[model samples]
Target: MAWQLHYTSARRGPTGRAGFQFVAETPGLPDGVRAGVTPYLSYRPPPDAPPSPDDSELGLFPVSLLYDRVDGRPLLLRCSYLGRDYSGRYGNFFAHAVVAEPDELEGVRPAELWHAPHWTHRPEPETPVLESLDELVPGAALDPEALAAWLSASGPGDPYALLGRLVDAVAGVLGRGHGRVVLVADDVELVARWIAVVSYSLPVAAAARLSFVTYTADPDGAAQRLVGTTPAIWASAQHHASHASAFDLRKGVRDGDASRFARTVAGCWRGPDLAGLDALGELAPLNDPAQEAAAALLALCRGDATVTAAEEGAAAELLSRRGPGIPEWVWRDLVPGVPSMGLDLALALHERARAAGAAEVARQCSLRVTEGVSDALAGASALAEIAAAAGVAGRAGVPVDPAEVSAAAARCARRGGGDLGAALAGCPGGSRDALLDGVVAGLAGARERERAAVLTPGNCDLLYAHAGRLRAVPVIACAVLASVGRRRPGHRIPVTGELLRLDGETGGEVDAALGEVWSEPPSAGECADLLDAHGDAMARRPALAELPSRTFTRLAFPGGDGLTEPAALRLAERVREVMPGGRAGRDAALVRAYGKAITAGPAGAARALADLADADGATPQLAGEAFVGAARRLCPRPPAFRAELLAALSPSARARLGARWTAELPGRARAGRAPLRGAEVGQRNELVEVVLRLRERGVTEPALEAWARAAATRWLAAKQLDVHLARSPRLRASLRDLLGDGPPSRGGR
Candidate 1:
């Protein structure tokens, strides 16, 4: 009752032949024993050469042990072939062959079997079960130096890192309590490294429980399905177990069927056909959550079918569980469809992404949440969540939307009275002005009553507290003052020094508002009227001295007469310190008024004039001219007053005025005023200097001939002129030619 078996090798071509040679008659040594020699396949035949029997049977192929009907003995048909080695090169190949039944193989099981070409003398080595590294390396030591070296050279596609991932996938699959696992990979290096990693990295129990298989290409044929179930020898990696069935992606299996399962492929392989599984929508479980999630997300991303809510939830859960290790492509595929997948899934992924320190992924998730939210409160809440996440991410060296953070804070402040200062504090430099503008706009929308409540005299610190930047604080403070003034017309809105010194748009707005409310009086009315209206308020805000140039000019020199009004002088002085210089075409009228005020002889008038002259340096000529004109117009009745005022000026000031007065002499002479006549000694000296200057400029001979005619009639009658000629040798020298020997005395006249 022994089974008879035989093996044969053949080739087909013009020079080739096919024949079944009787290699052995087998009453096999044991079920695992075989008879025959492995074929030589190291030298690959040319593509046009006839196919050989050794090349035909390269991988795990199906076969059976059949019982003979008459003899009651088993029978087998044996064929043999060559397969690629683990390294993928067709050299030094291990042989695979099947011995058939010649009177049936004795002592061998009369059941279905999977066979490959092999030599009877070269039995395949058993895969070593590895429970710990100690089984492979001494003391279970991890070589840190080797590891560091590898990592230094390793990148995203590093073989070792890929191997690590595959190992993790294997452990994950085995942890689910599957008794059998099949790994399929197209790459020789991946397959080889996977084998090594399994033995060296995985526990013995896990490694021993798994099975692996390889495939052979049939150029002109499809794989034949075996009738009965049996353990298949998958290359040298499969375990000799009766329950381990050969994997076929086209085969159907029930969910409860533990007898057969090909759960995952190690490399790129398609999932099992959906129609092949008893569960209608269930795909073959992937080896790891990351892969499973990526596949599921990809389905949604591709729009291949309408994904239900349940499927999206399942994918989100998978992502959360395996987020840190998931490849970047998965996120790239998943994020685009996140909005339609529901906010809950996005939220779940957001947390997972942030935890994994994938900042951009987290930001994308948060943005998707923002896009998905439809309700106002919910939108605001989503923005708040984004802002909070941004802060945390910022500290972690990750970026989120700072603008969104600012917007969220502003919204929250509007809703719950929160401080916007905190929201604005950490904004980047480029964003500060934009955030400040938002704050200002938000404050401007407040109710009149609300503004009055917070914009009180004592709440200046509140302005700084919420205004974010120092320059911006004044803007907001000034705005609040203007708004409160408009609402409560008589409200004593105290503006801060910051507001007074404000620049930019805020400064202009505040100044315009001040002019509108405490307006400059018309010139017909005295400056006393303006003082009566705004003096109390001006007194209350001493910081008014620091008002912006335009606002200071408006309040200090209202009606162009306030500078000279004794009643308005204190208020004028208070704001005068901050007056803008004349560069931008301001300060001319103010200078004139100020000069007139000085002539009025109010206390500190001289100091005021000096301050004005310094402050309006750009208009020094105008100021000097104004002072000289004012002295002439206002000090005429008391001629000595002019001398006193001129002496009180700085030497530079006096020089400027003297030059200006001398310039005016030609105009005065054209107006028929006596250019050489003056009431005060200083005035007389200035006129005498003008005449001496004309003489120096070569006008002496003509001027003396012209003046000699008028000198006899007008100049001799002028007593001050007579006295100057009596003492001043220079004055007498010029008139000596005109008077012809110091004549024309008072008696002669």
Candidate 2:
């Protein structure tokens, strides 16, 4: 697409008005005509006008440049109707042409097109550099001078892409009404070219509203020069600056210095400002896992960094890695969902984790910290929150400094005093128990005066109370004892049944601040006995549960005289121990079920019996005892219900206790009272009848036989026994002493 222009001839009319001629080589001209006027330009010299530079009677004309769409290069033409006369009807009107140097072109100013009257009176302004952008950029208007300057400095690469991004950014900044943007690039020349394109792309008036500055070396001078009233400023830099509002342009370019690069960007006043963070993510070295992980730290620093779903995934991946470059703020921000901690400790943890290559510990610690931090935040005490975070770290299998925990706990105690229970309650799950221990240790180490203030009788009671509800935490119980010793030097905590006792000032060397008191751990029997004597008192009063060394203690023990379903269940785990072996053990199981039956309901007793019978280490005899106890307690039940209960037990247990259970059934049915005449007599007969039916089904034993014979004798004398018993040969044989001489002799009645 070679583009050129030349003067072919000039003609003068008889009236002394000259007409010029020129030939153009513009390929693909409309209708295939290559010669015509371009730039829609025209000129008319005065009658006394001087000859042109070629001395052929032609003068200079100012015209805007045009770019070929195929390649971004400038083209010039001289004609009256270059594009308008594409049909060649006016081809003979072409004017002679002359090309001039840039300075020479600038020297001669042209009147504004179609506004010659205004320009004719006023001084003609310098030739406004313009370009026909319709062919190259559609509707865009290009500043020829600015485009020339930018193209010259843009070096090697696609500068147009950068131009598009800069234009969008400037448009956004303008819409925002105020903004501070810094464009980061490789060198000063590239930065300058980008700024030039962005500044001139907008309408001339709108472009004047924004200020542009490019800082290379001297920041102080640049800062001074930045003083202006412009609502928006777009700055560019080749290097990092701490105060810069930075946006990196090094997208998709892994430089291997990502860690250092990211750190510099992160240190900026507004962090990375979201402009090129995605690009920086690509800049991270893919070959080095450590460097990639390190690069992520800067992104994590921004609160709003997770701008996209991909970013969220990236954050998760980075967090899963073992990066040694973790900063202190990350740790501080992790706990309590807020940032407030010194760098030394967090830095130490980072170093330690880095050395051990245990990034998983950090990951787990962060998760656990978040899980428990909400409760601490609700507790409204920063110290308690810190302690809770430490506890969570411990739960996550991350080692935390004892001093840190102690200090946080001590501060919490000092601030909260008697409200320690409330504070502990605010912590969730394991963190609650963990924070409790720390509070005890921390308070114990305090001066006697300070300890006394926090461990006042009421406060100790409160702390002890909190300890009780906890599933397992011994230090809190010890702290209570310690506080008690301080108040009453030799007093022991009074536990029912004497299961646990702590003497003040024991001879054994111990932490005196913990009341210098100690007690031997109780045997399982003692703990069980204590729970039995207490009934639901432990459930009602948490301190009772906490007072015992075993944090797992609950109110229910099996052999209690008045057992409850809850008690039976609380001791369910230790059922075998409660009813060890032998007949005595069986009797104890019966007693437990009996107590539960009396207090609660038959259903509850049955459940308890089943649990006891099925417990590990339970003997067959004990199981039998439990079955009999549950069935006997359900006496006077319907026949079907009694059968169902018996069937629920193992075959051996049913066989062992069925007889004893049947023997008790008759008495239980009558409610242990003799039947009277009339309906009472009928009811008595029915009870014996049911027993007979049970015996017929092979459910009776020797005990049932003995009971049946005795019951028949008593019923006979009172006329409550059914005389028809003589009909059944089996009953007649068993009750012969009461049924009389014969089986009624059929017709003797």
Candidate 3:
């Protein structure tokens, strides 16, 4: 049946005047087919207006249609009231309405008949499916250019580089738009690959938002699940699918629902499977043996095993064909348990081939072994031995070169039980000491017992046990002298003493040797002794003088609460003793010592200093110095101290302290005295007044002001200043400063 729907253009107002009228159409309806219409007002008209008609008889305006004859097509009809209309003739009306056919509706299903206007229109376009990207830009063709560009531009201004922008844009467009755009295969792959890349590479905050979108878009996709299931994302989500879900997964897993986490991992593994493999490989080194073995096996299953069957077979065939004695034990021992057995087997085969007079087989095996053992310790040792033998034959009688000895020792150090050390030890007379020195130098810092064992007498005996060279005679004689002297207590020979006792320039050589062994800065005790016994020498060494004050302070303070008072008193004494010149030097030393003490424990040391300041012979100068030092150490740039110091003095010191102190006082005092109580109002007020006046004059010494404010606040809050400044104008000024200027004209009562 063709239906024509009528719509009112306007409604009745409070005055009871009729408004307007309009018409809408139901799709599949002929041009003149008539259907009754009704007005659905968002709010009802006033009681003075005319009574309304029954809603059932009038029918709903702009309603959807279900046609029994048509398999898929359905129509939507809408009607609205536009203002007052006087005519009822057959006039053309300009109105806004939506008419949709079923197949043309976006996101609409064809099974049932009814339709709505909200559905998006699905356009028929010929474009490649996303999966076709594999064939189009396979493998390396999809390069890192886009990724590098995105990463390079990832800072603030370029939002497109941010994963958040991409995620939000994708979500907004997908959720809001009614039309679809055709994406090229490259674009599809880029999007998919970019999602994978961002899941791993983006910063945590941006990645988190992107991960949410990915999971929300397709919960079943492997890549999405992997990104969602990562420890970082899972922790961020509070271990729940939804905000209301349980955070602890043990309950679910205990109830046999481990599938949730497991399936998430599996999903991640499924999407971009090779990327997953790469991740596994990257994490492999951190895994334990069992995990490594499992990962290696899995890698093998994934077709990335380092050793293959063809390589293994060739090694075995070569060994069988060209061995003097192909030991079955080699196969049973080294080959079976190892992961890269084929490579090791090939090297063994090459060794056998070389001994069996098979030149071609030997050459191939040698090449294979060389490639296989590039980083192996055994290979390095073998290479070093070959180089050393070649070196000795080319230049005989002269001492083996120090560089050759060093190289041979290093190879031996890397692989224990190798005889490089012995070979270097057996150099001809001229080269013996140089070679031994090389071995000792190489072995000096080595942690292994085997490397250090090269220095023992047995190894030295092999090189110089018989007829030692004249140069070697001194070394062997020295060792023998050292050994024999061990039998005597007071008669033991001293290497440095013996060198120094020699005549003429021989003493200079001893001095040089001693200098190499006993380099400077001495030790902490040596520095202390130097200061005690030879202060002049210490004064000459400027670097020693600049040692952190804490180093000396630590010696004075030692440990525990009981030591604080004594430490402070001792430190003051030390400062007086060492820094004897100007007040600036003494003051600097006091500040340094006080800083060390405070860092040792602020409350304890501060209390101790306070106690010391109150002691019997504590002159005001010393007391002031102590207080200033402690104050500076504790709050070096505190505004309250500056303010109080300014306040405690007249305008002269305030002027002297300058604009820095004045400008910083209010802010610093406010911050420093935040923990002080209201009881300190009077003294605090006085301090604040001084600080504000200073600030007005433009002094900004934060350290002095902070100290002054804190001391004054403590004193006044303790009721020490109530009688002194109860009725002062400075107090009023301080209060005004504290409260800030009165609220703006529009604010408060």
Candidate 4:
């Protein structure tokens, strides 16, 4: 019964026209089978499934079995689909039918079964089962020529190397070494050993047969999952399973928990399991405790200073030493100051001063924050300046004597409202997780929902206008220097989440670096000084000009809200200066700062668009493309800004864009050359999108549209076209919808 094929080829619905059919066109088959069979459908349940109806108690299902002929006997392929696409609405999702040649087939499970066995003891569906590949490829023999061809074609690593090792290991175990074999287990470690043993030999294939069974992956497939490696490889690879586990937190280095796991399992990977590989399947991941600590520390550094390349490298260098995870006690102590004012931080400082006869620990934490900032003078202190509220400069912003600072602190002790000193008095220790959560939430909150202070007396008050979600200064100030900086040519440096071995000798250097990173004590004098400078800058700028964007740590709306063309361009320059060395971090910060900076007024934003249109930086992939999106999100009149920007292109850019692309199209196509790229390409694409958007608003300028169309035409007409744009059917539809362009009739990019 298990081996028998069950398929229904045709069925009709309430309307005769609503019919279904599946007719196999196989050759050399007997007429014993009937044609035009009834349809069979596996049911799919909605996401919010209700209780089964009475008729659904017995459920409806569909299945197709697979077989191969051997010695005139039908050998069951036992192929099954292991998963389903959960993309669309529930039901058969017939729109996405899955049927292909056996070799090309991926196993997918049937849709949801409405009924379950009344008995609770029934085996739950989709649990991994051990199976043998030998049964499918029995009495295996290899063609030496074919084997040689395959081996020569295969690379020495990854997919190819792993396959070779696995086959070799299996062949060795079968006593057919240097010959043929194939490769599974439930005991993870033991199974890993079994796989390792097979790696020493290789296998040969004679002929292949393919069949498929369908299985939909349940959302919780990991509930009782097992390794998909077959029984043969698992048995063979057992020889090479033992080695030191990679740095286990439980047992530490020499224990070899992960190394054993990898050599046993990963190193033994042969091919997809006979039961079918679940594309959606996931392996339970292991981690190195030290790497986790470094990641947390990286997040800490990004909190305050706009993380820069130098700072990032320094922090990475600190972590690469791998002396230790930031002790759990460190987090426990730091959490209090992170979300609230550093009351507990100060208390700890005082206590440590008494107990250790020094205040180095708290001093280190303070120093970490100060050293991260590359430009202390330029950094703003909104909290300090605003709280000080002195006309030209806030209280903290003035160059008062140290006596005046002490007097102010005493007054803060009494009033205790928004004052920094008052907030720090008796610092509270909040839950560690809560503090961590707040820090994370604050990370990307710099540019969020624009709560435009429309009703405010002064519309240009950028501070209150673009005021971001408030977080304690300490939360931003406290940082962790992740110092695992290693650079090898052609190797990309990882930003976070990596665990590499640290030379044991560097432990002292690691500690010293960590100490230096956090060594500076919090100085009220310095913070006040920063605020004073910021206030002075703010006071000099007219209140009616721009959003009050200057802050204690960094300038927000730099060059005032009515930013000049140079200042607008300098925004990208500022982004370039504060890049995180890594492209991803830099792009995110660039987009974020760009969005925040342009939100104040349309005057500066228009010029910013021009600068961004000609942007050059670390993230050429995003280029000026993202600035368009960021500006749109923050701009009050995006369409108008676009229109204004289109009216003025930099001379070089305008000439390059409106030149002979169309006239040279034929020759360019013959030569398979692209028309434009880099800044020009990005700017061109941006113009097209903006023009399309403007057209949507019942507006169209002939020159603007012509320019945009020509740019789009050149991009589409490029001889060596990008595959994504080339193959996209929706490209025409999108153009028609957005810009009302007809389909390209001939060769294209």
Return whichever of 3 and 4 wins on lDDT: 3
Candidate 4: list runs displaced more than 4 Å.
Answer: 1-222, 231-358, 368-749
Please list the C-alpha lDDT of all candidates, in the order they appear.
0.39, 0.39, 0.35, 0.29
Model 1, span 206-308: residue lDDT tens: 2233433222222111121121221221333344433233332223222331111222221111222222221211222323334344445546545434555
Model 3 lDDT on a 0 to 1 scale: 0.35
lDDT of 3 by residue, 589-626 (tens): 44444445355453345344444334342233443444
Q: Please list the residue runs of candidate 2 whose C-alpha ends up more than 4 Å from where it truly belongs after superposition.
A: 1-405, 412-723, 727-749
On residues 1-749, what C-alpha lDDT tens digit does candidate 4 reach at each position? Answer: 11112221123322333223222222333343222111222323322233332335213222222222333333322121112223322232221122222332122111111011111111112321212221122111122223334433433234333443343233232332122221122222222222222221111111111111121112112111111222333334435533111111111122122221222232223332211111001111112222222323333322433333443333333333332432333333433333322222223222333244334544443333223211221232321322222111111122222232233322322232132322222212221122122222333232222111111123112111122211222111111112211211111112011111123344343334323322331122322232233323322222200111211012213222222234433433433343233442344354444554356454455454444455544344343444434443442244345544434545443233223222222443223344654444444444455555555554555555565554445445422222323554444344455435555434444
State residue 22's C-alpha deviation in candidate 4, in Å.
Answer: 46
Task: Estimate candidate 1's alpha-carbon lDDT, on a 0 to 1 scale.
Answer: 0.39
| Candidate 3 runs further than 4 Å off | 1-542, 548-629, 632-749
Tens-digit lDDT track of model 2 for 490-597:
343332212232333322312332223323323335444545665344333333333332311222232232233443434443433532343323444544554564
Total backbone collisions, model 2: 7
If scored against the real structure, what TM-score would every candidate get? 0.28, 0.27, 0.21, 0.16
Give, for candidate 2, the lowest lDDT window spanning 10 residues: 111-120
Q: Give the TM-score of candidate 3.
A: 0.21
